[model samples]
Structure formats: C-alpha cells, structure tokens
Target: MTDPDPFRVIFVCTGNICRSPMAEVVLRALAVQRGLASRVLSRSAGTGDWHLGERADERTLDCLTRRGYDGSAHRARQFSAASFAENDLIVALDRTHERILKAWARSDDDKGKVTLLRAFDPHASSMDVPDPYYAGPPMFDSVLAMIETATRGLFSQLEPAVRAPRTTLRALRRPDQEDLP
Candidate 1:
C-alpha cells in the first residue's frame, strides 16, 4: 500500500537566504519532474537566525529563476533541535552547518538524519555547498549548479522509496463465475 505521508526533507545553511533555499527549490522542481512531488516534501532553514523571516537573497532568487525554479516564497527560519522530529532528512549546505546540526541532535537517529547536501554527488570535490551570499551573480549561479547536481543525486537515492506503489486492477467475479478469457 502506498503511504499517505510525504517524506520530509529540510535543507540548512548559515543563513536561510542562500544555499539552502536554492537546494530546497531545486529538489522540489526535481520531485515534480520525476512524478514524486506528492510523496516528497522539501524545506529549508538556517543554522543561525541572522535572516529569520527574511526572503531568500535576491541573487539566489535570480539564479533559481534563470534555471527555471521558483524561490519567491521561501522565508528564512532557524533550524532547531525540535526540527529533528519533523523531518526525515536534514541536509546541511556545508560542513559547519552539519557540525552544528549533529551537535543539536538528541539521539543517534537524529544525528544520522543530518548530512551534507553534497554527500550524494559522486563527483563532488568538496562536501560543502559554498555560501554565495557575498559573491556576485556568477558565484550564485555556480552554487546553484552545485546544489542542482547534488539535489539530483539525492533525489535519485530517494526515488525508489518515495515512488508510489504500483497496483494492478483485477476484474471482480463471483465465486462460481468462470474467469474471463
């Protein structure tokens, strides 16, 4: 049977305005393209509260727009220990965020759920998705590209489990009725 609940994922960065939001929207767009939109849930947060309640950085939004993904609705929020109970996966944009998240984890399970976003990218030279906050548009684009590659890899790993269960239709027949030819 198909599960009714969606698989929740939350992306984290130093500030919710950059890398994490980019990853969040990229993953959402990918889920939709792969037909797993209903089963997969994507969200983002910051390791710190510096940008809480603020929208994603304009450059981040611009990068997403150029790539055909939407980031207009994203609002910055802080990642807390309580978030562990709400998300199945907690993706950190960099090693710093990962370390912070791991420290906040209350149990082994919570610690296991926290991981670097680039961990899924087999070709990744580094595990961290660089922060492009102070960089120019070109850097934002580069970071978005990195996030896209890693997010795609992550989605591939999740596809099998999150995919809707397939079922076949059977013709109903009475106990005494012969099967249809």
Candidate 2:
C-alpha cells in the first residue's frame, strides 16, 4: 500500500539561525531514531527575515555535529501568514514567537497550531529557548541540550498519532484487497 501523508511540523525562532534550526534538526533526528521519519516532515523558519537564505550559526552547527545531528543544510526563512496552512504544528522557541505566530493567524485553528517548544519538556523551568547567537560555544551547546530534551518529548507524543492514519487505512481495506500494493 502507498504510505500515508507525513505530518508536517515547523519550528520558529527570532532569526532562524540558532534555536529554531536546532529544534528542526533535533526533531528530525528523533523522528528518524524512532523510525517515524517517513511519517514526519520537520522544518524551521524565522519570525523575521533578517537572516533569510543564510545558514544556521556556526555555533549551532558545531553543537549539532558534536551531538551527531546534521544542521549543515539549514537555510534561514521567515515565517509568514501563508505558513500557517502548510504545517500541522508551528512550534515557537519562545513565547514571543508564539505570540507573533498566533497574531498572524487568520483563524482560531491556525492560532491554535502555535505552541512553545518547551511546552513539551516536562522538566523545563522556562517556556523560552534562549537565542545563543552572540554567546560562546558553551552557551550554544547548552541551548542545543534544551532543544534536544524538548524535541524528544515532542517526538514521543507525536509517534502514535503519526502511525494512526496508516493503521486505520489498512484496517479499512477490503479483505480481498489486502494483498494489493
């Protein structure tokens, strides 16, 4: 049988050079680790266009590499009102981005899609994932750690839901069509 549609998720931050890209990479890696990569499409964008077309910060790349996640191909893009329709979830690195996204929403459903990344992290002490752009490498690593923790939590919650549509579709197939591709 054909595969089901992948669940689309986009991470948003101030400039797309630090936190959001890290969250994107972390979440993608987690989905792959859990064998849900085919059922989840992860991406990232900035709340502002200042860094559009630029790669993630060097520190962000280094931290991701040290942890075995790839951030090499990330290019900055801005989140727009149009983005609300493309992603199933709009994850914000901080409350500020969350507010911006929700305010840009055209409907209640679109507004509801916006959430803070740390909301998934049960042990998190803050809702915001701080930007490490001007900070040293150590701070970048620390931020990445926060992203990894929250992303793992997010992936765990999404796994079963990602698999549900395929399972239901297969069950609804006729007995005679079970062997059909």
Off by over 4 Å in 1: 1-3, 164-181
Q: Tell me the deviation in Å of residue 31 in model 2.
A: 1.2
Residues 35-112, candidate 2: write the lDDT tens digits: 888998999999899999999988899899999988999999999888888888899999899888888999988976
TM-score for each of the candidates: 0.88, 0.90
Identify the candidate with maximal TM-score: 2
Go through the candidates in order and give each one's C-alpha lDDT.
0.85, 0.85
Clashes of 2: 0
Instruction: Say what the RMSD of model 1 is.
Output: 10.8
